[model samples]
Target: MMLSAQNLTLARGGVPVIAGLDFTLAAGQALILRGPNGAGKTTLLRTIAGLQAPVSGTISGADDAIAYAGHADGIKAMLSVRENLQFWAQVFGGGAIDAALDAYALHPLADRLAGTLSAGQKRRLGLSRLLVTGCPVWVLDEPTVSLDVDAVAMFAAAVRAHLASGGAALIATHIDLSIDAEVLDIKPFRAKPVHFSGASDEAFL
Candidate 1:
């Protein structure tokens, strides 16, 4: 398995939000996380990406193997598009940026400062970083936030290509990307509130 979670419990702000969650993603597969607002999808992804500790449970196959892209663009404003990709590629050991540029149609904007690009362009640049990471597992949250139809298609193609190359993805998205992926709704795993028997326990709750 590329990633696996057993009896996973996630927390936000020190309060448990999800419990008893179990899922696994093997190479060349994708798992789409579906939930309404305030669901713990983001928290679960973050935990799996090793950004934070889970309230409880064990996650296997995450060490040095996952690339995460959150709501933020995670780019340097002062750098050009090419530079940003180069930096990430180097950080993940080393790789040429040409494939990443071609994958995301970033060649034309290679010389443009990242801060000067439009929202969609910046989002493309941000998403392009994934291709340079060299990791086999991708953890994305709302990856298409600022993308248009064509840009979304580009992102989807990149994901498909990654999968074809034996990579796996765990994503939380609202719209359909037309990829062959399994949907995992997290609402069913919402954590129940802990009961308080004593006045002191009430404070903890």
Candidate 2:
């Protein structure tokens, strides 16, 4: 699943953030999107995920080939951690819940409701949702937010393994994640007056 953005112009409320942005990623290649806060990194990620349509240009790739994880932890606070995984597993048809839970070290919190979890714990639960998605292109926004050193390292290792298995990712982060990826600076294509909405992340799914 190759992702290509050509002459991509992203905007909010009719204001352009980034224009003439072009990028392509073949399998096994990771592209890291680095920029300061409010630099339209999230907007670019949203556009790529088809959650937001570009003001101009086009984002073309395999259908149902994308899996996105935004900065917000898309967990139901009322539900237990394992319940959340079960929901996503059904959403993507099926997946190994126990495996993903163990991978993110969320087993201990599996029976606990997400509302009772800390910031880092919630983030781990959020990331575990990725394993339930059946997609080759990963569009992750601020993937390491609220994560500790070990979690961050685990996140990177997981990404590395995904890439090694011919999976591609478009990751946005303010801090360095230390993955072997091509860096993309969105400053050159920042959309002015960007007002993003309908971005509950899952609603777009």
Candidate 3:
């Protein structure tokens, strides 16, 4: 599979935040997005996730083949670890929570409420959703935001495994993630304001 963006432009409240962005990623490959705050890192990811409509240009190759994990982790506060996994399994298509939990070292907290878990724990839970589906592309924004060193390593390991298994990923992160990936610097095209409505792509480009 291949992911591409052509002269992508985006606006929020009618203000430009990203302009003329373009790139492509191949299966078993990864792209790292780097930029300062307000640089449209998250917006870019959202756009590729098909949750945000660009104001101009086009984002191609984002469809049923992708999985998006936003910065928030998307964990249900009211649910326990297991419950959360069960819910995501239903959405992403059921996968083994026991194995995923074990992989993320969350087995001990499987019965605990997601609201009670630490920030890193929540990120792990949210990322584990990747394993619940067979989607070929992944869009992750600041996936290691609150993770510790070991956890970060674990995260990289899992993502590497995913790529090795023939998947692609677009990651927006500030911390240095020591993984082999094509780097795309978005500072030059940083548009201000960054608008997103989680609507149809037709409304934007």
Top-scoring candidate (lDDT)? 1
TM-score of 2: 0.88
**Can you write out model 1's per-residue Cα lDDT over 24-80, one digit (the tens) per residue?**
999999999999998899999899989999978999999999999999999999999
Error of 2 at 5 (Å): 0.5
Please give, for residues 71-108, the per-residue lDDT of candidate 3 as tens digits. Answer: 77888999999999889888877767786786689889
Indicate which candidate wins on TM-score.
1
lDDT of 2 by residue, 41-110 (tens): 8888888888888878877884689889997889999999999999998998986798788788888888
Question: What's the residue-level lDDT of 199 in candidate 3?
Answer: 82
Candidate 1 Cα outliers beyond 4 Å, as residue runs: 195-205
Cα deviation at 52, candidate 3, in Å, is 1.4
Give Cα distance to truth, residue 138, candidate 3, Å. Answer: 1.0
